[model samples]
Target: MHRLKVQGVPLILKSIVQLLHFGYHQAMSCLFPVAIFGTLALSNVVHLPFIYRYDAILLVLLGVQYFLYRSGLETRDEIKVICLFHLIGLALELYKVHMGSWSYPEPAYTKLFGVPLYSGFMYASVASFMCQVWRRLRMDMTGWPGLASAALLGGAIYLNFFTHHFIPDVRWWLTGLVFIVFRKTWIIYRVREATYRMPLTLSFIIVGFFIWLAENISTFFNAWKYPNQHQVWHLVSFSKISSWFLLAIISVIIVAQLKYVKARRVWGD
Candidate 1:
């Protein structure tokens, strides 16, 4: 009947809309990593001015950032956040390279303290991807703690990475703290017509795993080398996943400052 046909039409149209929206977001999320991998592949093959490869990588990353903002794929606010991530990542890279945590193993005009400037852009790319996905997917959260709690934890986690070289590693303790603080937190993400949810801590681990995989790709392209890989490329040790998991906590805290919904519970309790 006409009434039944009219009712079915809205449902069909809604499904199509949701599917398209989901695909759009998925593609946007893939763009950053694809660009990085593509550039890395090309850098291996292309010949240019002495040390120009590293400079090229830096320019490519900067160009991508500019394009994203110019194209309105990233808002001014998101660009600012990505810039902050770049500085943070660069600082860590400086310290890590100084500590001999990883080696660039290549001469480059853009080298500073033996780390290429483009290394920072790798971290920025993560923020760019996360920001894009957040906007595209309409991400939301619940049960988030106060900003102080997250900032304090995130700050300590970052400092620990450097301090661990001199003192006891408290990463395990911090990991416990993350669970305690975020145990009730849930990340709500949309895909197609339905919204799905996952615990925030678990999401960190999952994201960390993927970043670890991405790390393999980066190292494959000789982005940086662990001590073990000085002679031959090898799979990054799985233990690094723990570090990525903790670093992801810091990333969430920073991104959440831009937009995160508190849970329906008393803050102090």
Candidate 2:
């Protein structure tokens, strides 16, 4: 019995070590997002001379991006992808703000069509997290759908975000399609030496929930305001999770496509 107990000690120690490694990688992957949130909170408390809070936050984020690139934390290709997400997000914010879905009450020279330019960074941060975590974890996927089908679905999901406001919300329909499309998909990731797999859909939900939590934090900092939150800051509605879930799916598809293209280029070379 003593020998058995002694042998088990290595297993326990290994488990602890792996957990620490996982946590370290996760923190590293969240650097961009942490920077964004930190800027939001800091800008709220500290006023800069002559510059509006939103504009200040944008400048800080741009500086952070430049630092990340110079530090070799983000690759050039990754930066391009992040910028693409920024454009996509900015377009959505423009439409949503126009529809009165949310309001950026703070005055800023960077405002366009009633939306702050910095607002795009919130979406770009999501792409940053996805890109960082993918590399850190050495992630890959199995049973991925065809590129055409996947892109079509992703495009549909995005269009639904706008179309829903005009027509009946087909979000649930798209959700069901997501399940069907990705039924056999699994995301394989490595932590330390061991590997694990999880359903891709499950990952979307997990990421969505976390983003919802981040949204609450952003709103608390007065980054933007929902109608209900304008009077008093409170928890964002739980139903927003569904919207984020779809957004997560879109992010994943975009990143996955980029990865696929890179891999093909490498193989061809």
Candidate 3:
């Protein structure tokens, strides 16, 4: 029994190392979240529930995505702009916690005022990773209205939220206002990058689609429990999702407009 127990310890450690030391390729990392979801689905046979665990693992995929970023694909200045997005997002989260825009009654852990540090790191990392992947692959960013479209899209989403009584959180509203004002400022002061135009529009489109998928899936689960938020018309909820999608696109824009993103896959550019 002692020998058996000793042998099993190494096997457990090996499994962990394999999982954590996984590959860094973009396609593999992007699908990591889906693969985790599949495992969670399969585990139902063993009478195990895996909602939170899967979320954490999905977050870990993003944690790994961070190192994949390459220097050629984007500039140092562009990276600073990307970092600014995180600063804004983290500040918004702080407001959320402060205003009770959202709250955790009894979290399993408390790393940063009811939210884990990994929550911020994973999100910020994923943003940089995803943008770099598409930028590197030369994924058709051709001929999008670029900044103008971003502003219009952001405005439309914000307006919908304002129109609905469901938009109660002042912080959320102010957050939307921040992006709007930022875009206008980018247009005015950032003369060169502001007029440069996007290499592709689908980057934003694809991100938006993913956000919709997540929101729809959450609504199905009833875990998030949005109030009276149907697909057709739910003001605050719709605004929130739309805002997320728009903001991600705006991140791309902020990075791209600063000439941060560069096509690196070519033999030599």
Candidate 4:
């Protein structure tokens, strides 16, 4: 027992160091989008062309995306994943904006049907952060359901976002699906040399909460406006976290597709 304790100390410290490194990279991935948005918001005081600000920000994000790949900060596979997320997000944005779910107040040369192209990056950033964290921490999962069931759940969750405006909102029903499907799912992440884990549903809530907080920051920057915010900017209602919780599930499902295909896990029964 004494010898075992002596050997465990170094392993424990190493895991802590690795966890910090993972956190740093995770933070850096999000910084790219938030920093760009914040800077452009601040630069509003400067004069620019008809399509300058929004288009310029879009171009800058594209450049950053390319640089991250070229610099090997992001893997090719991760790049593909992020791009898919961008398209998925853009499609959703187009629909939501058409439905009057949210409004992008700024005009841009890159606007398509009243949806700014840069808006896609907001969703893609979530995937980028997830991918970076997954890679850095060597994440894996236990008790994930079959792809078919997951696809059905994802479809329902997404459809609920649109259909809710007119039809009955089934989000609570889908939330039940999420709980049932992921009840046993565990997200295993490595800190350094040690592996740690939490329930996948809990991770969904935690990530959703942070995204909700980020939404507050984004709204404060006037990235988009909710109906209530049109009159006064207030803290986004916590109720939105339930919506973000659903979106986070979609993001995780997309990233998990790649992770599931590429990596075989030891935990699945």
Candidate 5:
């Protein structure tokens, strides 16, 4: 374990050196989008059956990473620029959870409040991968593939409210608004590029439908109970469809990002 820790320090130091090599301006642009998505995943790792209280305990470690990365003799302005994005993102996440759109159990044994810390850091790394892929493929394709993500997020929220599974008393409008803006933003970019709209629309539909099968598998496995056990299904577990879709989109987005990078090197970027 001591050797592992000593070895890990060099790797951590290496990442810092590499990130510093990136310079400040480039890092700032990519950080926000990365953090937004990463926290989403950390939320999942917390609940993984593989480890109990994995999410809560990770916060301290994540905090250390966050500070270490933001440390050294850096400009306050630049630090604030990165910090503000996470603060807002984290705040928004808190709001989203409070609204009952999602949740994590008590933090007594963990550091995460539904969203885990390393998860945010993890997303930051993935975003770096995505940034490279986006450069080669162009924003439209990355954003294009992401239309499915936007819908899977939007549709699940819609279903939650419609089914009366999760009620939103206040700030519910924010959820819909967030989805609309994201969807419209993607469409605006596509239309601006004068790309074919039909194919893009079809892609989202296909991804959405793709989630149904995973829901069936999980239902059979008893991995979940729907509507917080308010509504249960015996034939096939349909309760987790939205959450599954959300998870699916994240998985695909990351894989697509990696594949885009691999294809570029093979063909010579």
Candidate 6:
């Protein structure tokens, strides 16, 4: 028994080391997101002269993006992906604010139809995270559906976000299609020589839950206000998790397609 206990020590140490490595990679992947949230929190407390808080935040985020790119933290292709997400997110923000779904409720030179320009960074950060984590984890997918099917699902998910206001919400139908589309899919990731596999849908749910938590933090920092949060800062509705979950699906599909394309190019070469 003493010899068996002694042998177990190496296994325990190995597990601890793997956990540390995982945490470190996750932190690195979250660099962009952490920067955005830090800016939001700091802008709330620190006021700069001759600049509105929102505008200042926007400038600071732009600087951060430049620094990240110049410092080689984000590659050129990743920057392009992030920019795409920024535009996509900005469009959604514009429509949602117009529909009274949410309000920025702050004055800024950078406000476009009541939505701050910095608002796009929040979405860009998600793409940034996806890119960073994918590279760090050496992630790949198996049993992926055809590109057309995947694109259709992602496009439908995005459109539903807008169309639901006018038409009956078909989010549940979309959600069902998500499961169906990814039924055979698995995400394979590596950590320090050990490999792991998780269902693609499960990864979406996990990422969505964390994003929901981040949303609560963002609202607490007065990043944006829902109808109920206008008076006082409160926890965001849990139902928002479903929205983030769908959004997560969109983000993943975009990143996955890019990776797939890159792989095809390499094979062709």
lDDT of each: 0.86, 0.95, 0.45, 0.84, 0.42, 0.94
lDDT of each residue in 1-269, candidate 4, tens digit only: 99999999998987788868777866766755665566557646554655566787788788888888898878898888889989989999999999988897777779998888988888888888889888877888889987998888998898888788899998888999999998988999876666789999999999999989888888887778887888889999999999999999998987897788766554463
lDDT (Cα, 0-100) at 206 in candidate 6: 94
- For 154-179, candidate 3 gives per-residue lDDT tens digits of 54544443443465535355445445
Error of 2 at 54 (Å): 0.5
Residue 80 Cα positional deviation in candidate 5, in Å, after optimal superposition: 12
Clashing pairs in 1: none
**Candidate 6 Cα outliers beyond 4 Å, as residue runs:** none
Error in Å for residue 71 of model 3: 14
lDDT of 4: 0.84
Which scores better on lDDT, 2 or 4? Answer: 2
lDDT (C-alpha) at residue 147 in model 4: 90
**C-alpha positional error of residue 190 in candidate 4 after TM-score superposition, expressed in Å:** 0.6
RMSD of 4: 4.2
What is candidate 4's CA lDDT for residue 45?
A: 56
Task: List model 2 lDDT by residue over 48-116, tens digit each.
Answer: 888999999999999999999999999998899899999999999999999999999999999998899
Cα miss at 65, model 1 (Å)?
1.3
Q: State the lDDT of candidate 1 residue by residue for 145-182, as single tens digits.
A: 98899999999999999999999999999999999999
Better lDDT candidate (1, 2)? 2
Position 215, candidate 1: lDDT:
96
Query: Any idea what lDDT model 3 has?
Result: 0.45
TM-score of every candidate: 0.87, 0.97, 0.45, 0.87, 0.31, 0.98
Clashes of each: 0, 0, 5, 0, 2, 0
> For model 6, what is the C-alpha lDDT against the true structure?
0.94
